[model samples]
Target: MIVTVQPTGISAADVLAVARGDARVELSPATVEAMAASRAIVDDIESSGRPVYGVSTGFGALANTSIAPQRRAELQHALIRSHAAGIGAPMPREVVRAMMLLRVRSLAMGRSGVRPVLAQGLVDLLNHEITPWVPEHGSLGASGDLAPLAHCAIVLLGEGWVLGKDGARMSAAEALHGAGLRPLDLAAKEGLALINGTDGMLGMLLLAIEDAAHLFAMADVTAALAIEAMLGSERPFLPELHSIRPHPGQAASAANIHRLLQDSAIMDSHRDDLAHAVQDAYSMRCAPQVAGAARDTLEFVSLVSSRELVSVVDNPVVLTDGRVESTGNFHGAPLGFAADYLAIAAAEVGAIAERRVDRLLDVTRSRNLPPFLSPDAGVNSGLMIAQYTAAGIVAENRRLASPASVDSLPTSGMQEDHVSMGWAATKKLRTVLDNLTSLLAVELLAGVRGLQLRSPLAPSPAGRAAVAAVEPFAGTPGPDLFLAPVLEQARAVVAGRALRGEIEAAVGPLS
Candidate 1:
């Protein structure tokens, strides 16, 4: 696949294709022309000798200092070298690729006053699979993800470490040489333009949103399975019930649950008994409500991500009228808030799932299922420890759920006093989602076993497919066997999308 980045914008799908799928990247002709036009403005400003923020002047706390015209090239080089100070372990390959693509997309909007070749240098990095070895720390997210992006920008100058096409660490010079590409000689405002944006956080946010979207869909499927396994009433998911509240996400979830439970024999077996407790517990009955809220939060986060995608988040933007102006577009508050919101929402999803898993393990709550759904009760120990694992992850997720955006410290000699910490937000969001995936996998294991113990009483067609999908990983339920591998295999079923795929194939697409 070839993703032609336009001046207008790129889509989240395109970003994923290039970042995760190694799709080739190309700058649209219009983007090239737009970049050339913007560069012309910077050149005129450079020769005129009037002081500009990133053109003739120094950066950050040194903005007021003027530079000799002959030393401007050195200034750009110094900016990249000095700012490439990120520390910690290297980031994942896909994240670095996404950040590079987003920065190029921002420059392609023609407001960063950078040359076409500079933007193409980034594009070349993507196309050739030359991923810069960016460290995991050193971004305040105020003046963009400075340290992280500068780590990337240094590669453009052939002065940083990189993972070559074979994914082995090497010098940027060596990687560029192998790719038959030359290092760019950045001029004037190019270095500042390269590093000054919310690309890193925004890229992480985009990838998280995509992953969350899939997991949210899987949340509905697993919730339906849990509901069936517990012999819970499916009435709460009635469209008419959710219609009154009318939240789009809620309605979609309710509809998914409703369709997933259609004609379910496990539910049908108890329909005649009004004595089956007046209603199910909140975790069982209100699955849609909780997961629905997460869906809605993801939608809002995606809206913020989409807007940032099309926006030019440079420090001093070049105007169509030929004037260069400094603005606060680089601040990451919006991305920070979005990433934190997603973490909280995802944590809630896991919280409710843990509750449901706990219910399945306890004989007091799980109706007639043996303790821990163990076939041999005390001797087998069954899935008792699985609930413990789920609870532990849920507790950790709650800590990760604390909004990173709320905590900020001054940086750059108080020049950037109120930093966004959005990078921290996105980083924690990844952990939250990972925990959520594990928590849901626990629910899948317990839920499927609970359904199995309700012997001879079959589940819905969709539920039957779900059981088949997991039985291989979970094994025949009996005396306790080696369980670590079983639980890990079940987690693969949940995280790898096999369970959702089987359920959907049996019952068509879910909401």
Candidate 2:
């Protein structure tokens, strides 16, 4: 698929296709016209010898200093090299691609006063599958992920490392030459244009939102199966029950659990019995409430992402009326707050899932299921350590959930005081989601075994499908043997969303 860059902007879906799906990119003629118009304004300003913030002067604390026209090209090159000082492991390929694509989107808007060739060069990089080596650190999320983006921008100058078409790490010079691409001599404000935006944090935010959608939907499915494994009541998920509350997420979750529990043999067996408790534990009964809140939080985050998608996030943006003015549109506080909020939501979802895993292992709370779901209580450890792993992750999530946006630190010689720490927030959000995936996998392992221990009573059709999907990877309930590999395999299944896919196949798509 080819995503055309236009001055009107692109959507989050378009970014996802380019970033993860390796979609080719092209500059619309309209974008070229916009860039040419903006470039004309910049060229006039340059020839007039008027001092603009980025076009004719130094940056940050050095903004007051002016440079002669002869050294302006060198200024742009020096800016990219100095800011490319990020030191850490390289960021993922998808993130770099997304960042590069977003930079193109910003420049295509003709707001940063760059020529059409610059945007076309970035598009060429994407089409050829050449990914720059960008480190994980060095972005304060103010001045819009400067250092990390500089690493990417430096590749355009043919002076950095890149993952080539074959995914091998090679010199940017070699990669560009081999691909029949020429190195760029960055003109006035071009380096600042390339590096100034919230693309890194925003890219992470978009990717996290996509993952959370699947994880949150599957969370409901896993909770439904856990409820069945514990023989919990489905009455709480009734539509009438959620109708009064009217939170869309809650209603959707309740509806999913209710649908999954339909015609459940175990539920039918307990429907008329007084022995089953009048109410289940909060973890089981309030599953929708917790997961639904996370759903709503993600909706808000998605809203923020949508706004950012159309934004021209550069330091000195060119206006339609031919004025290039410095602005703080590059600040990342919006994305930072959204990422922190999402981390909290993800952490809570994992916490509740962990609670359910604990309930399945506890003999007292798990109804009459064998201790730790073990066939022989004393002989085999069965899933006991899995609960421990889940608990540890939940604890770590609690720590990670401490909002990164709140701990603002000043940098750039105090010129950039009170930065948005949005990059840190997005990075932690990824970890929280990863841990959530693993935590839910542990729940799936125990929940499926608990349901299987019920024998002829039979789980709901969705539950049976979930069992079949997971059993191949995690193996059937029996004496514990080589449990770490089982947990890892189950993690892969959950991460791949195979369990959710099977459940959806059996009971239609979940919300």
Candidate 3:
């Protein structure tokens, strides 16, 4: 499908489409107009001989130095080459695509004063699936993710390495030329306009935010399954109970849990079962509070992303009245804090999921379930070590949950003082997501095994659907087997595969 850029907004789904290589991109007329207005400002600045920050002078610690008009093009070229110093593993192609899209979108807003040709080059890269090989590290998350974005700018100049459609790394010149394109000669403020922004951090966070949203929904689904597996009370999720204190996320979580348990004979039958009693443990009862907090964090992140996405985050924004303004909009404190909050929320989910896993394994705590959820506790270890793995992941999450935003170190001889470390925060959140996914997967697998021991007692319809979704991926307990694939499949479901779709079709869409 043709994915035209609209000034109104871009969605996560559009990004996913581009990542999957099923979409083409086009610049909207509004974007073209914005670029034209921005370029006009640049022309006026150049023609009037006013010294703009990046356009006429050097960057960062070298900002005081001025460039001669004759060497301006060389300065722009060197700016990209000098900053293309990112290191570590290459980022995923999707992240590169996201970075390009974000940069293009920001430039399209017209405040950056980049020429229309430069913005269109980014769109062309996306449309042709030419992804720059950006490294995962080297950004302090302030001063606009300079290193990674420099790599992107280098690709535009056709000087860096980029991945072709066949996944082979080739020179950007070769990649572009092979597809009937040529390198761009950046005009005044074009290099700064392209490289000077939080798009690097913003791109990764955008993808992570979408993943976190899906995981939040999955958290509720997995919690519902565990609640039914333990035959826990449904009273805590009652609408009237949530309405008394009405936080939107909490109310929404309560509603989701209620919907998952609705029309379930297992839940209905256990409601009056005195053996299960009036209340469940805190892990079961406080699911809304923990999960809802994560949802709230995501809401805050969405707000921050919305602002940053459309903003002119580059230094030296060009006003329509032909005035140039140097500013620190490139500082990433907003995204830094948002990423830190995301880590905290994600850690909480893992922490609570670990508790649920513990509950499912401990025979006394698990009510009627066998020790370690094994039919033959002595002969088979069953899910004994799964809980250990879950605990280890949970412990790791606690360390990762430490806020990167709270810590900063001065860089660039202290001229670029107070780094945001927001990129670090976002990167750590990705790790936390991976750890949480595995931990939750382990729990789901263990809970299913425990439920299997319950046999004809059967879980709630939602729980049964969840179990059936995972059952095909699980194997009966055997000695010293590789359980990674089983854990992976469970992670896929917990990450929101359409396992619930079958049940949804028979019943209705899961709330």
**What are the per-model numbers of colliding residue pairs?**
0, 0, 0
- Give the local distance difference test score of model 3: 0.81
Q: List candidate 3 segments past 4 Å from native.
A: 6-13, 20-22, 164-168, 475-481, 506-511
Q: Candidate 1 lDDT, tens digit per residue, 158-232? A: 889997556567899998898999998989999999999999999899889988998898888888888888888
Instruction: List TM-scores for all candidates, in order.
Output: 0.98, 0.98, 0.95
List lDDT for all candidates, in order. Answer: 0.90, 0.91, 0.81
* Ranking according to TM-score, highest score first: 2, 1, 3
Query: Candidate 2 vs candidate 3: which has greater TM-score?
Result: 2
Ten residues in a row with the worst lDDT in model 2?
A: 161-170
**Clashing residue pairs for model 2:** none
Overall local distance difference test of candidate 1 = 0.90
Off by over 4 Å in 1: 164-168
Top candidate on lDDT is 2
Write candidate 3's Cα lDDT for 1-511 as tens digits: 7767765446656766776554888889898888798788788777777778888888788988988888888898998998899987888887788888878777877788877888889888888778898888878987878898899889888899887667667799998888788899987778878788888778778888878877777778778777777878788999899889878888888787777777766677677777776778989999998898788888999899877766778788887787789888989899989988988999999899889888988888887877887777787776788888889999999999999998988988788889899888888888898888887788778767766666677676776776788778785444434677778888887777686565566446543
